[model samples]
Target: MFRQSLPAGIGRMMASMLGDSPPSSRQGADAFPSSQSFHTTATLAAIPDPYKVLGVDRNASAGDIKKAYYGLAKKYHPDTNKDPNAKEKFAEAQSAYELLSDAKKRETYDRFGSAAFDQNGGFDPNAAAGGNPFAGAGGFHGFGGGFPGGFAADINFEDLFGAFTGGARRAGRGRRGPFQEVLVGEDIEVQTNISFMEAAKGTSKDVVITPLTECGTCKGDGLKAGAKRSQCRQCNGSGTRVHFMQGGFQVAATCDACGGAGMIVPRGSECGTCRGNGVVRDKKTITVDIPGGVEDGMRLRVAGEGDAPPTGTQAAPGTRTQRGDLYVSIRVAPDHRFSRSGSDILYTASIPLTTALLGGEVTIPTLDGEVKVKVATGTGTGDRITLSGMGMKKLGGRSRGYTPTGDLKVEFKVAMPKYLTANQRTILEVLADEMNDKTARRTMNIGKDSPPSEAGNAPTDSQKNEGFLKSAWHKLMNATKNGDGGNSASNPSKKESDDAKKSDKESK
Candidate 1:
């Protein structure tokens, strides 16, 4: 396992205990300190117990640990907490939860002690080298690179720090080696509104977005021409440093000098285009192809079109930066004449009452175009006429131009006339009487005060009386037919009696 060089206070104490010279910083060619000189020994640097940091016991359940972590996080979150120590407390809680929540990590910590992790924290599978925790499975042994039964090699201190902190160094990032950290940019979302027809037929639209792109001059390296790199003095080129706690427990933290890159270009050697940043803000126009039959609230994704990673971030030796995705949110506007259900479309068709009763061909709008549909006789309001294969195209289960489609349902609505001509009224009344529509007959008096017939026939006074008598005779005949024996009691009118007497005299 790789251990970072000890701090000044701890270094002096360790030197006194081991009877060695005080640790001295290494002087590099660039006037930068690369490392510290110390004796080779598998010494244990104390770290806060995961249980104590979360204020929980060793026997605490996962639920209890999580609860404690959440409480600490909410109380000491940097955005809400104003105290200077709050940020450190929040980090401590996060680290504790990360370690204790993983069963394997917690078990290992319990078995081998808090500073021991699988490969990174210096676990010796062989255990032959005096059970020393710093004797790594690889050839390397201890902090000074030599042990009684092990070989010498460089140690990757970043992995050691990550193992101690439950891999917080690469949290939320892509999987990469300890030397190369892959940082993915953040996704961007934009909303746009389209008309109902456009949604059905599909349309192309251009969207403008301002995102961070790689700096052309620096080629995303953030380094100017002839710039020389140097080892970071803070972490001694190890990319990490140690923090001692109250109980002599030491925690590994990221070094601030190189932003965890382990190396740096001096202040004057920055890219002119991005000002030492690997990215620059630029506006780009993208034409998005909106497939047909896309519904409202549908999102379209454009790969590799999102923003760049944060500023001053440098990829290690071999890794490359990854851009995020661009998402377009669609909003379909409603239409007054049309509505949709799945792939089916509904259209309301209004026709005159005469056309509904007599049946006629009426033109209606469809997704394809306007077409004449036959309206059945006696068609009432809310009646639907389905035109197969005339609706929106299906967006699933098949490729474009070969997919099945839905039907266009045309619903009928009878439109009543506001006013009727005198002739039309009279004809309707006659028709109602012929049909024996009692409601229509009572609602509109049929004959009294009616205009002359369309055939120019006007009834005289006698003709009117004769017509009255004929109506009475028919009523009596109907009564007899119904087994009433024509005994519906009623006195005869004077005109009717006089007509009867004249008819009797003529018969004699």
Candidate 2:
């Protein structure tokens, strides 16, 4: 146990308690008569009645005793109250709580008063000289010795101070025991554009960056050669200041003068290169790697390529300064001929109507080159042809042999001719007649009694006068077969009737 020196007031009180005659009655008496007398008085004054110190009755419950001690401690803690006597009052409250809160100590105190634990009639002057007046007893000792049942261990100094300081004691101001390295550089972000093909395959480009770097002149010391250093006057070299807050709370913060370094160069000796800032803006070229399969608006990080720390400051004794990071955002240009879906590419190719109906070989365009593809007979518009492993490659190769390659999907669009020559129309008409004959034969085999009339032939008047239902059914069948619906006329015209009768007679 280590004993702290007593204050002037406590020393005077101790001396008065040790003398045979009252010191106040003596003319021109010294305030602290002797060192021995001072120690005795301090020990006696320290051992006050626990019930009186805590402001509770002798029969008060343990809960009552704790509540009183807590209230007094909150009112007297040095951090909360700025009064000169706050520390002493808090110590008294702590001592009272230690004795009254314990069942054994409270019972002993109740029966014997202050003398129960003191075997001697009065405190020994010789023992007081040794610094511990309550050496023999385990109870009611000052802060200098161990308590009766390890009672001092139960007191939480952090908790008591934390209630008022809000844990500021462990913040940035007091983190370092002697010195520590701190972050002084900031990260930077920029955007760049690349072609669509460059994005599909990987490409690299050099980028110029202008950012702050350590000054070369004065070697980042922020001072000229042989400059003198001095303690910071603003914070008295402690690197922190106490701030009085709105709610009667005091908080500790870093001192602005020294940037929490506790030392600075004298006023007349600033380095000229960085103008005492310790850093300067400079241009640097960095090569960036663009991986395949990266999407637009994606960001890539480049390590150790950003701003540098300020000059005139060194990292903590065992640590190194860390450079900032560079973030590069990518923009990919759009391709007119192709579109993408995840890892797959989509393209559309137009084919002639003859190639769609007759079937032929058509050349298809791809990313690498052109390739011949077979257009199956009757291939319709909007039909898709897939070429495997012809799309963009995966960004980072593959996983499980899957997602390594994409397919190129080619969609077919049939192009119809708008006009035909007279000779070509005549040949098409003859082909149409032959196709109709074959259709009529096929229909007759399926239970039709009569074959269909030839081209330029028509039906008789009776056939034209058939019931409206039969006429409509025949018209609908013809429209569907020809792929065209005629005008909405219900009856045949005069010229059509005459032609139909002539054709019917000829057929018969």
Expressed as tens digits, the lDDT of each residue in 237-330 for candidate 2 is 7565555544322345556677655666667787877766667889988889997777788888786677876645432122235567788999
Task: Provide C-alpha RMSD values for all models, in order.
Answer: 16.4, 21.5
For model 1 the TM-score comes to: 0.56
Q: Which pairs in model 2 have colliding backbones?
A: 14-41, 220-312, 221-312, 278-311
TM-scores vs. true structure, each candidate: 0.56, 0.49
lDDT (0 to 1) per candidate: 0.66, 0.60
lDDT of 1 by residue, 258-374 (tens): 666676666888888887777899999988888778888999878789988743445444444668778999999998989999888999999998899899999998877788889
Candidate 2 TM-score to native: 0.49
Identify the leading candidate in terms of TM-score: 1
**Candidate 1: Cα lDDT at 451:** 47
